[model samples]
Target chain A: MESAIDTHLTACPRTISRRVPDAYQPPFPMFVGRADETLHQVTMAYLGVQYRDGGQRTAALAAVAEIVGTFDIADGPAHNDITRHTDKEGYVNLIVVGYWRDPAAFCRWLRSPDVNGWWDSPERLSGELGYFREIVSPRAEQFETLYAFTDNLPGVGAVMDDISGEINEHAYWGSMRERFPLSQTDWMESSGELVVVTGNPADGGRVVVQGHDNIALIRSGQDWREAGPEERALYLEEIQPTLQAGMDFLRDNGETVGCYSNRLVQNIDLDGNLLDETYNIGHWRSLEKLERWAESHPTHLRIFTTFFKVVADLDKLRLYHEVSVSDGANQIFEYLNCHPSTGMMRDAKVMASR
Target chain B: MESAIDTHLTACPRTISRRVPDAYQPPFPMFVGRADETLHQVTMAYLGVQYRDGGQRTAALAAVAEIVGTFDIADGPAHNDITRHTDKEGYVNLIVVGYWRDPAAFCRWLRSPDVNGWWDSPERLSGELGYFREIVSPRAEQFETLYAFTDNLPGVGAVMDDISGEINEHAYWGSMRERFPLSQTDWMESSGELVVVTGNPADGGRVVVQGHDNIALIRSGQDWREAGPEERALYLEEIQPTLQAGMDFLRDNGETVGCYSNRLVQNIDLDGNLLDETYNIGHWRSLEKLERWAESHPTHLRIFTTFFKVVADLDKLRLYHEVSVSDGANQIFEYLNCHPSTGMMRDAKVMASR
Candidate 1:
């Protein structure tokens, strides 16, 4: 294979030749867990990138390239990755999202010697650099995830399994089956593929075929520098108003629809300059409620439709959507030395054990 | 005064009408104590601006309007105010810079019933709301502040006294009196008017003339929407790089020369939108050290020189500079549940008694 790749690249100028490994394993592997019990927790780690000058530099970003460094560590999460990286001048940001099979197990690992030495090291505590962390255990049912394909699971999805090994079970948009089926489908239309991985009957639950999914994702163009009057109009006349109204409607209405939180993110360069990409991650209590809001909700349907159209025409810009669901036992969250607005921390007692 | 406003507006029919008070007092008051004491502390309060929509409507802003409400309470500092208010869309920023005679007193208030109840309330705990507080306590000698004139104190300056009550102090730029002397001159250039509030010889120290002052403040025009190519260059080539580098120099070197922390603030509406104005608040251990950096520091000198040139040429734009020096005792700091980057939180433990 190495010779073949080297020879192949020789035919093309400017193509560097390198040896390729013939036997390969996925950088991150699926979770190893008990067959009978429910075991999983969601973990989100917030890491900061420190800049020296013109270059984007930080140990945190570099650490991300070493994928699954802690995957095999005892009591650690089943999966982890530097899921998000954003940069601005003088500062860079890296976010690691992962999932544990058990909340207690993850906590134990956190207090263990290896983890404590790294996080609580004297050099780290020096305070010269900036850093923060947020850990959440999503009550399994509290979340819904949709993937483009069964082979790839992101963050928490990597810790849990689908209902079946193949795409045999049919799942609807707002049904219970959509979240945890052994074999899953891209019912939310956000995840790219439709293939499914088999699941264990003894483990948690499975996604049974329902009908359709309700979760709606709104993504703007990747670049909007030439964002003329038309682009601004989309934000002002359509996008902004729709989002504001939707949030208001959902909050005022109720929680059955699965909407729990709203998150907005924008990409940035090392200089902290704003990027063209923006993502809105909203939580839904259930897919049915999400569907109702997407299909029947008067204001939301219009807003989402317009967003879809704007992205359709922009060639340089790309948009994506996804949704996922978790069972109660597999979800978890922990908020530490943080502000009141930190997820669940406001009401959570300071250092109080539940 | 009321009639004069009415007469002046006669040329413009659209002028609004409201009665002006004949007698007025500054919303925040000076510290009360014996004069011979060190009598200074640095306070930086991060107050959240709640967002319902696009408006800057927030209890935090409203609370700031009622200045020094907690100053009189026992264990509370003699003065604190929402000294800095900057806003952006969906968020409002309020910063209350204050000083405490004793750092311990500030900690007492944080744990007291009044502050805890308001901050720890259920409404505040909801993850939907954003809230954070950063407390920095620079040793008295660790910080110096400069104001354009007498009678105006921002953050910690509000705690210390100026040179004279009647504008008699002739303090110059780079004079020791700018920071520690009983009476100070308009060394900062940002504070308006050269007037002094009468000070009791027994109550704390005054801005005594020792030598030079450090710390620079930069403010552009009221709006930057039309900030053309020149403006962009100033930020890209001069302002941003200089600011970033200056911070690096201060941190890399020890605090002997008045270099401690770098602060850059932009004026914003209640809605948290950016304003044209920007303020740089850097802590200097001493005035002479600050002067050394200002006059000799390669990157900073270049930055300040360009800033001076630009502000000198533009009529619509405004630029101001000031420097201050404080004693160790009066320069107390209190940090509560905050990231290590917060003033001294990295060294200060959570709720730990010093």
Candidate 2:
């Protein structure tokens, strides 16, 4: 029996030549995996188009919907979920991420003739309407899991629910499926010791945990270059205790499924000037673990108390947290899987463990 | 006696310190125009933030409501005429391009302390929660009219009518102007001639009928290196004959209020890639004049026929139109304007005309 992929190809013969060389060829094989079992990291970027005339509003909207739809249809059975982001402003952005059982599944969808046909459609063409433009980049990085806890193995929805709940309230959650799927790869840079765990198999979804240890260093300041060495040292010293406390809390908390204590030294764009600095990013198995550490853990509580006090007088600080769900993958191609921004960062933390 | 400006300065002392540097200052002044002759432009850029999360559905619907509000605001003070255009998709491309009389009065309500307080409120800062980054660029361009029709001018009702008609059929245009007395600017550019009509009575709300020959050539795109000589020639040839025909039609038809012809061009991305290259943009004074030209005149008929043929085989094309009342100024500022993808092109067209 012919598969849906085969049928789609037969129905829509590829009529347009590839704008990029070897466009018809799959960029890479697709990888599918069970929710808790698959460990993948993804990244993505988005661009939006605005038009000059209000009358073309419908046409512009149609064009965008069609483009996204094309990608969704091409990903095939391996496709897991996709989410679009837009502000009532004339802007549209979408995120596609997920896990697939194998790489070939993704490749079939990416190289299928139906995907090509959608882009070549004259009715939904971008050039004729001159209303919108978009670019999507998806890539996968391999990750090593330290621990995972789930009642029924692991599925996309469970991971997504955990991640989404950890982050701020967002409106586009359930519909992410049917859009894209997740995949894995071996390409990545080993930076620090990281650990990952997924837990809570009975009542709720599993928790995937990753931890990193003995990282670089970081300090917070309104402008780092302008700071004296003493100030920078003091800032670092002030925050170190808090981080240590957090680590200790993680060690003690039963709900804690994952913990990471690593340093991220990155550049800061301060009014056009580039400043180098470092900060800590970590993940826990659940909000309960994070809250327990924050509220009751002695070391963690003390560190945060001091850090907050110091930054209270300062204009800017480096510390930030991103809670996210594994919404799946956004497949720009087979080798690439674009994860949501917050979730991608967390996945990065997992990669650091290896 | 102190004016309201003085009272405002005294009341909102924080505006001085929070004001961004001059370089970051908006290119145009901010003020509410009176109902009879007010022009306002609100430009928003949603590239970065809107795409960050699952934002597409919420953002798109919100944009539709926002455009509708702008049209509703214009309906006040018996300003019953309006016009707008959207791209092939539902993204709002442009709104508000006509005429009004009492911009000062309109401004009074727009800048009321109640509204100002909401924007200034600590809990609800204007930019904090929205998907699109916004730049409210308002300007007062000067125009002297030489023609007049009935005192009927562009307003919210007219905008609502058009929007309702479009929405009923397409679902995109239906809610553009449900609220009243709001305004925004849309900027776009075209590789066409500059036609400026000046030196008429600036006081009347209606179009002036006398200054037909007072056209000015501000700048031409023919000198640009990126545009080739053949393309330039083609552009000029295409527009000149149509312009002449329009002029003749205005001269012959007693019902003609005013006439102007413009050529719309594609927008370019930050990396300088041309986007949306298929749409053709032209401006007309009134729908009646356009209809008459299309119906009886040979030159206009031929020009339009050629245009249709050129776009016939294309997959899809979006043609947008807006009729607005102007306060003799390009109400929206281009540089500080947000929706840069399309707004930049619109600005280019205005500069070419200048």
Candidate 3:
């Protein structure tokens, strides 16, 4: 690893190869260990419901929540969280997020009698409440994770063993792509176009959107709960502005830059109290597009420079991100009685079942 | 109406009664017409799914989207928008937001052969994808809508008839509460505690959180797409700063001021293009709590004053909000295979089913 860093000192900034110094150390820790071939698959699952009129909302959710609480540690996800959010449509949605290092384990848990039986029950479709489960499984090579503080972890981090100390391939342009193990052998280009699987959402029918290859998903997060007043002020006043600007650029004009959709959200407690945490979740057309934006975009440049300038003064402020490139075959887009602009329904062509 | 406004000139600022000049017109149009008792109920529906690994995601979503597209105008929501966002748990979520002025219409649509048949099909539980529907129906008196522009209506506004000329109720504190017709006869106080209907989420069982009455839901939005460069700069530089500060206060310390949860999110197009729109959706314990914050809090005052100060220069910028206070029995929270912090699952007591 040391020799590799030395050899890449002259690596082109435009190229995929990474350049780093022997004594270089990132201000934060990151995830590593692709060498462990056995740990190659990771899966995430969300089980949720949407309801209103109070007639059956409470009863319906209780039925589902009860089932989730019955799984044993061995057969269940590594970690789980229950959250609620009001969708843009004004419905309060309750979601249970579960993570598994092994997709097979997730399958087993889903196949369990109690789980399958509840889903199979006719009560689920009794017009009382709406229920759903969404899951994603990605190979180890398809994803990467980084962290600032090891204390409070999220998503895959909650299931992973540990985070690495100062690593060589970060803090520079294109480091996000350089960190991806898949990027080593694959350019992660998107192939094909989005195809709608059913009728049009605008006209009201079952709609499914099929995306192209090598789509990218990113979760970049910040945590300042442990920050002192000074560090907190520095983050809120200095670091946040540039970060928000970059995010705003992506949210408003990302398509022009290879990005798809971006959302900046604050994490709150179940009772609705806001926590000192926030994150940006987005989807990109391809990993290369994301890389291009991060490498050359002025918005990202400002965020990059601001971080470096205030790195020393920032303590107890954790900044980390996870990036993954998934095959088109591994995506899902669906809607029912939804607005026309929901998901990829409007972007993709309707599928011809013929 | 003129006499009513004049008579309330000395009305307590902290009370629900509104006071405004007869000639004073708001810069933006607002929704009115409580006199028409026929339009008493409003319903919002969210039919969505969560999926990943590519195998069932696109297919499942397409299936659902097709069903939504089949609804006829008279039997369907007045308007719809298909949107997608990545959930905090790492799964991509696609949702169709639908609105109906009559809950009966929503029920008729949901019970339609195509809709119910599709939902009841055994394939729904075939482990291909997770599906759900979340709906909220509130009487006209319990909900209020305000819009800056009639052209870009959202949520209930999309289904509403026409916007009214300058209304006398806005631009002051406590105006939000006063806008709700329900406030005239009811204080809109919360009545019950959240009771978990099922098992514990931490232990991997089904969990349902039943909430109390008068849970306040507010959606505040901003649209600056029509603004020119100067107006945009004023919003981005001067207005946005104070607005965000106020939102931040609610997000981080909302519990102290009656907020339950607050999420600041950006609206995006189907292709993931960032729209020139953003909104903050929040849950509050009670209407009074929210009223107190908007009335006396310095943070809100800053937002109010800032908006008034720049109202003239902000020609094309649009600002709007919808506030609804619902009975606790109307609220539904359910979790499946989720983490403890997913929703009210962590805060409520577990149901002791005898």
Candidate 4:
């Protein structure tokens, strides 16, 4: 039964709640939580380098290693990881991901002479080497995290103390929104357009595109390394196929449903060997459309039904996701010598030079 | 000299032209051209799978291999490549890229029982395995390609007959836009907001977001595998540092300048080893802001100055890029069980349930 307060809290009649049914027990205990209060805002920074060819990455590798070393020391990121990936153009991306529990610390690190000097160095203009850093800081209320197991947690989990025990909010369509603390009062509505606030490409040099408000970002992860052979078989054979279909629908045809881009990626080791984890990173125009996909799409329905069918027997599988709605004022969209179809460039407006 | 006809062709007085100075030769005679005319509209598709963990990827690998085998048919793509990468969430991603010279052929293949059945199969919804396919088709006029060398051409290069010799347009800030055919007349301005046309996240269902018009995309590449030792040194030591600095400016602080997201990625082989190629794929709000970065920003000036100083000795360095402005209607972005901070979600709008 819904209490008057609960009803009032979720003003929208159709809105879901994060509160679990009274005395309801989950088939398997799962956990999800956020960073400590000290981390009122979390900052994630990806500093990377792109070499023209793989044969000459020694210098680039050393560059990132040094930076990683710097971040590993005191007054640095709470957690950091070095990862690799190759893009459609056959570019190898070496990224050093650093998570800061405090925005002030992140800002301080950025302004530090060591970091600024490295970024401002003239040697970075090599015709064969390219470098970049992408940083985002979201308030505690803007983002959420969930974990399947306590070991080997990624992202904000590094700064978090412990995995809070399950308190409902799983196996449902609107559960994600319900999990978000922001849903209490704010609808998280989107505002503004992907409008150009500066020069156009025709005049050519560097073009900057401004993003809209409340653009949504989601990183859904699944870690099932500890599953027993039988549960693993069930997951691999039964649940996985259904999940793939839903992901495939979004990857190939998500534009129809408001998805901008979706990548179903697996985790790997330094040796290019596969790891025991995988995740789907997607960008949506708004949180509403993402909700609609989960609530009504046939693709997701199959995923929903398939998971529930074997929920009782699947004890080892770990599933969790985190979603954040960003402020447009904090967003960035710039292109250098890149393809016009890259990223937000596909849909942003081109304004005349200011 | 501006021919009367040329003046008439370029309606915008402020727009730059692709024509080079009279009889002016490039330092190393760089080459750039488009894919063969046979490819009126090119379609690029990426088919991939995501597993719960790396330990259980044997099945996923076999699945992709089977699909790759099928795509190798005579009626399949004109070219293809298999690549790998790990994302921020530590997910391993295996991608099989296929390029088609004809969109109709791509359509035909998508509907083929072999491909269609594979995609539509109920077995794909497994809880542990996720699959996805991303496809994009751009008309000949909508895209432009450039190459520093003839060998190891990527993207449309596989379909091209030869690397057309230098035709004069080189070494300029606005060169990318000048290289684009659409820039000759069309301003490529954006025309819509990222609006929600359906259900909100609160509704707990699938929601569809609508995109606007005239979004741009760019794929700028650098292949220095064939560069001489001295040129490589110049690139690795002198030129690279400066380029990295500029890229860093965009990556770290580009939000203030209008960039949505930028990734400087290198190309890697299957073994997770670095390759001899690299590129930067960026998403901008518009072509205009990109131009501003290039034209007035000091970061790009260093890139331009450094290249000019060493242009004479850089004989083996290969640098090329392709830019395209997409129709927003053809775009797709969706997220399922993903972290909220992924991709364009950082600044998109969120509408209420309709």
lDDT of each: 0.38, 0.27, 0.62, 0.59
lDDT value, residue B229 of candidate 1: 71
Q: What TM-score quantifies how close candidate 3 is to the native fold?
A: 0.43
Candidate 4 lDDT, tens digit per residue, A251-331?
A: 667667677656555554444455666666666777866765664454555565565556555566776676777777656
Task: Show model 1 residue runs off by greater than 4 Å.
Answer: A1-354, B1-94, B99-112, B116-179, B182-241, B248-258, B268-270, B284-291, B307-316, B321-327, B346-354
Docking verdict class for candidate 2: incorrect
- Best of the two (1, 4) by lDDT: 4
lDDT (tens digit, per residue) of candidate 1 on B1-354: 111111211223322111111121212111211122354444444443333343444555554443245545677666553323322222334554445645667778767777767665655434333344434443343333333333344345445544223121112122223223322212221111111122211221221111122222211112233456776556556666766566556544524444544445565543435555556555554343454455434455455445544543443233334344433322333322222233322112232231
Q: lDDT tens string, model 2, A1-354?
A: 111111111223332211111111211111122223242332221212223344644554554454445545644433222333221223332323333444455456546777545433553322424221111222221211100121211222222212211111111111011012211111111123323333221211222333232121111112234446655665557765456455544433323333322222223221212243433333333222333234333454355445434543442333332222222232121101111122212332333343
Off by over 4 Å in 4: A1-29, A34-36, A48-67, A85-94, A122-125, A129-132, A150-152, A195-209, A224-254, A269-274, A310-317, A332-342, A352-354, B1-354
Model 4 Cα displacement at B274 (Å)? 69
Q: Which 10-residue span in candidate 3 chain B carries the lowest summed lDDT?
A: B1-10
Fnat of every candidate, listed in order: 0.00, 0.00, 0.00, 0.00
Candidates 2 and 4 compared: the better one by lDDT is 4
A6-115 in candidate 3: lDDT tens per residue? 22222333333232222334443444422244666787665556565457555646755674574563578887655554543555555556878888887788788877
Compute the DockQ of candidate 3: 0.01
lDDT tens per residue, model 3, B106-185: 87887888777866666654554555554567777788876655565777777765555555666544456667766544
- Report the TM-score of chain B alone for all candidates: 0.44, 0.28, 0.75, 0.74
DockQ per model, Cα: 0.00, 0.00, 0.01, 0.01
